[model samples]
Target: MRLVSVDIDGIERPGAVVTGPDGVDRVLELRQFTGAGSLALLLADDVALDLTRTAIGRADHASLPRLADVRLAPPVRPQVILCLGYNYRGHVEGHHEGHVDGETGQDALPYPNVFVKTPNTIGGPHDRVVMPIAATDVDYEGEIAVVIGRTAQAVDESDAMSYVAGYTLFNDVSDRGWQDRSSQWALGKSVDGFGPLGPWIVTTDELPDLGGLQMEVEREGVVTVRASTDSMVYGVAFLVHYLSQIITLQPGDIISTGTPARSVQAQSAHLPLADGETVTIRVTGLGELTTTFVR
Candidate 1:
C-alpha cells in the first residue's frame, strides 16, 4: 500500500494508503489505528494488513477528510540517509565524463561507493529546496530509496528483502564543486533541503519486481535522467547485505540506491538551479516527488 505523512490544519500527522483512479489519497490516521510514526511501524506487524482490505475496511476515510486537503510531510522520519554513488554503470560513465574509465585508467570501484546524508537534509515532496549561494553547481540525482523495517546487523542477501518496509523516491541534490573539492561527499550532499523524499512509501509486497522499475528526473518539465533499476551495478538486496556488515541498520533508516545515468553534471556545465526552478522525479510504482528551488 502507498503510505504518506500529512499535516492537517496545523497538526502534523502520518498515514495515507493509496486509493482510487482520480488519484485521491485516502487518510489512514496512524495515531488512531496503529499508534506509530511511519510505514516501518506498520510493517513490523506479524500479520500485515493487506492494502485492498485496509482501504475497503476503513470507516475513517468516509468520516474523516481527504488527503489533498492536508499539508504533506516526508513519509518516514529517517535516522540516516545512506546513498550510493556509481551504482549504475551509465551514471558513472556519464557524470564522470571520460573519467568513467577511472582516474588511474583502471576501472571504477568494484563495490558500491557509499556516503551519508544527514537527516536534516530531508524534506517533503512539495517542499522548497533551499539552494545555497555558496555553491553554484547544484544538480539533481534521482534515486529509489529503501526504508528499513527491522533492526539488522550482518544481514544476508537472501534475508535482506525481509528487512525492507517500503520504498520512496529520493533526490540526491548535490553541489558538484563542493563534492569534487573533498574526497568526502558530506559537504556537498548533506546540505539542508538537499534530500527531497516521498509522496508516500509503497510497501514491499506492492512492488515485488523492484528491479524492473523505471526512474526518471525532470527539470522544469524536461526529462534529464531516465533509466531502469535493472541498470544498477549492485541491487537493493546486495546493498542491504553489504551495509549491514559494516553498520547496524535500524527501523526508519533509509538506503537510497544510487541514481541512473543523467544529472546536470553529466552535461559538463554547472546546471545550478535558479530560485523558483522545479525538479520532479518519478519511479515506476513509487509515485512522484517535486521540489522547487528557493534562495
Candidate 2:
C-alpha cells in the first residue's frame, strides 16, 4: 500500500492510496480505522499496519478520494533527520581524499560518514526550496531514505531491517560553498527547506529488494544523475546497525541512505542548479519527488 499524509480542507490527514475496483486511483482515509490522526501515529506500532490492511480489504468506495485531488505532505514527521554522505562509491569522484578507491582498501573507516539535518529543513514533496544567500553553488543529492519503525540500540545487521517502518525518497540539497568550508556538512545541508521528502511512503512489504532499485534525478527535464542502489558502499541493513550502536534510533526518525554517482560536482560537464530551476528525483517503486529552486 502507498501511504500518504494529505491536506484536505486545510487539515492534514493520514491516508492509504490504492486502485479501486472501478480502476481509479483512490486514497482510503486511514484515520478512521487506525484510530490515529496522522501517519506518524499510524506508524508508531505494528497494530496500526494490521488495522490498515484489514480496512483496505473491505473499504467503502465513497470514503476514497481521487489521488490527484489530494495535496501531499511529508509522509512522516521525524524528530531528527540523519543523512549519509559518500555512502555511494562513485559519488565522490576525487572531491575527497581516498574516494577514488571506492571503499575497496583497508584504510576505509568501519563506520559511514553520518550527518544530521534539523527538522525544519524538511518540506513537502512539491514545495520550493529557497537557495541560501550565503552560498552560490547549490547542488542536489537524490537518495533513498529509511524510516525507523522501532527504537533501536546496538542492534546487529541481521535485526536491522526488522526495525524499519518503510522507505521514502529524499532530496538532500546542499550548498557547495558552505559544505566545503569545513569537513562538517550540517551547516550547508540543514538550511531551512533544504530537505524535500515524500510523494508517499512505501512500506517494506510493498517494495522488497530495495537495494536493487534504480535511482535517477532530472534537472529541467534532463537526466543528470542516474544509478542503482546496488552501488551503495554501505547497504541499508549495515547502516541501520552501525548507527544504532552510537545513537538510539527512534520511530519516525529519518535516515537517508545516500545518493548514487554523478552529482553536479562529480560530473565534469554538469551544471549547478540556478534560480527558477527544478530538480525531480525518482527511485524505482518509491515514486517521484520534485522540488523547485528559488532565490
Candidate 3:
C-alpha cells in the first residue's frame, strides 16, 4: 500500500492511494477513519498500517478525491534527516578522476560516514528548489530514503529491517562551490528546500528485498546516475543497526542512503543545474521525484 500526506484545506492529512471502482486512482481520506490508519493515530498509537492496507482494498471510491486533484505534501515530516556519504561502491571504488583506488576503497572504511540535515530542508516532491545566491554550481544527489517505523536503539543488524516503515525518493541538492570550500559540508547540504522527498511512501511489505533494486537520476533527459543498492558499501540493515547503536531512531525519522557517482552520460557534459532546469530521481518500485530549479 502507498501512504501519502495530502494537503486538505491547508492542513496536512494522511491518505492512502487506491483504485476507484471506475478504475481511477484516488486518495482515500485516512483521517476520516478516526482509527489506526490516520497518520496521527498510526504514529501515536503505533497502529499497524495493515489496517490502512486493508481499508484501501475495500474503500468507498465515490467520495475519494482523484490523485490529480489533491496536492501532495512531503510523505512525512521527519524529525531528523540522517544521510550517508560515499556509501555507494561506485563512489568509493574508482568512480572518477582521483577517486579512491578500487582495491582499497570498500573495506577501508571502518564505519558509515554519517551526516545530519535539519527537517527544514524537506520540500514537496515537485516543489521548486531555488538556487542559492552564493551557489555557482548546483548539483543533485539522487538517493533512496528510508523512513523508520519504530523507535530503536542498538538493534541487531539482523533485526534492523523490521524498524523500516517504507521507502521514498530524495534529491540531495548541494552547492558544489560551498561544498568544496570547507571541510564541513553543512552549509552546502542544509539549505532550505535542498532535499525534495517523496511523492508517497511505498511500504516495505511491498518491497522487502533491496539487494538488486535500481535507482537512477535524470537531468536534461539524460540518465546521469544509475546504481543498484547492491553497490552500497554498508547495506541498509547494517547502517540502521550501526546508527541505532549511537542514537535512538524514532518513527518518521529518515535515513537517506548516499548516491553513486555520475554516470558516463553526465561525465561527458558535466554542467551544473541552471535556472528553470529540472532533475528527476526514480527508484524502481518506490516512486519518482522531480524538482525544478529556480533563481
Candidate 4:
C-alpha cells in the first residue's frame, strides 16, 4: 500500500493509495475508521496497519477519490526528526560528488555523523518554504528518510529493519553561511521550514530491496545529485541500530540518511535557490517529492 494522508475539505486525513481498474490512482482514507487523522497516529497501531491492508486489498478503487485532486500533508509530524550529515561517501572526501570513495580518507570515520532538525522545520511535500531573513545562501540536500514504526532502544543491527515503518523522501535544506560559521550543524540545519518531507510513505513491504534503491535530485533542469543507497557509507539498518543505542526511537520518528555527493554540474556551477525556484527529488520506490521556494 502507498500509505498516505490526504486533504479532504481543508483537513488532513490518513489514507492509503490504491490503483483503480482503469489505471488511475485513488485514495482510501483511514482517518474515520481508525480514529487516526495523522500518519503518526495511524502507523502506531498494528491493527490499523492490518486494517489498512485488508481494506485497501478489497477496496473498490473505481469509487474512491482520485489522488491527483487531493492536497497532501507531511506524512508524519514527527516528535523527533534526526538526520545524518556525512553518511554518504560522495558527499565529502574531496572527490566528485557521486563518485564512490575507498574506505580510506574522510570516509574512514566509522561513527555516523548525526544531527537533529527541530520539529518546526518539518513541512509538507508541496509547502512553499519561506526564505529566512538572516541567511541568503540556502542549499538543498536530497535524502532517503526512514520512519520508525516501533519503539526501540539498544536495538541490534540485525533487528533494525523491523523497527522501520516505511520510507519517504526528505529535503534537508540548509543555510551555507550559517553552517560555515560554526563547527556545529544545528543552526544551519534547524532553520524553520528547512525540512520538506513526504508525498507519502512507502511501507517496507512494498519494496523489500532496500539496498538497491536509487536516489536523484534535480534543480533548474540540472541533475544536482544522483546516487544509490548502495553507495551509502552506512546502510539503513546500521544507522537505525546506531541511533537506538543512544535515544529511544518512537513510532513516527524520522531519521534522514545523508545526501549523496552533488553531481558534477552542481559542483562546478551550483547556486543557492532563487525565489520561485523548485527542487524535485525522486527515489526508486518511495515516489517523488517536489518543493517550491518562496520569499
lDDT preference between candidates 3 and 4, better one:
4
Using lDDT as the measure, the top candidate is: 4
Stretches of candidate 3 off by over 4 Å are 21-23, 33-48, 93-107
| Model 4: residues with Cα > 4 Å off, grouped in runs | 93-105
Task: Please report, in order, the local distance difference test score of every candidate based on alpha carbons.
Answer: 0.75, 0.80, 0.79, 0.83
Candidate 1 local lDDT, 1-295, one digit each (tens): 7777775554556566645555466666665445644555665663544543455465445555576776678877788789987777666543542123344311257667788999888888878888877976777878888988788799999999998878998998987778767566688888888998888888777786477888888888888888888888888888899999988998778999887777555455435788888888888888788889888
Collision pairs in model 1: none
Model 4, span 177-260: residue lDDT tens: 776675666787889999999988998888654688788899976788889888888888888899999999998899999888
| Candidate 3: Cα lDDT at 48 | 49
Every model's TM-score: 0.88, 0.90, 0.90, 0.93
lDDT of 3 by residue, 60-92 (tens): 887788987888888888878899888887675
lDDT of 2: 0.80
Ranking by lDDT: 4, 2, 3, 1
Q: Model 3, 120: alpha-carbon shift in Å?
A: 1.2
Which structure is stronger by lDDT: 1 or 2? 2
Off by over 4 Å in 1: 9-11, 21-23, 36-39, 47-56, 60-62, 93-108, 263-270
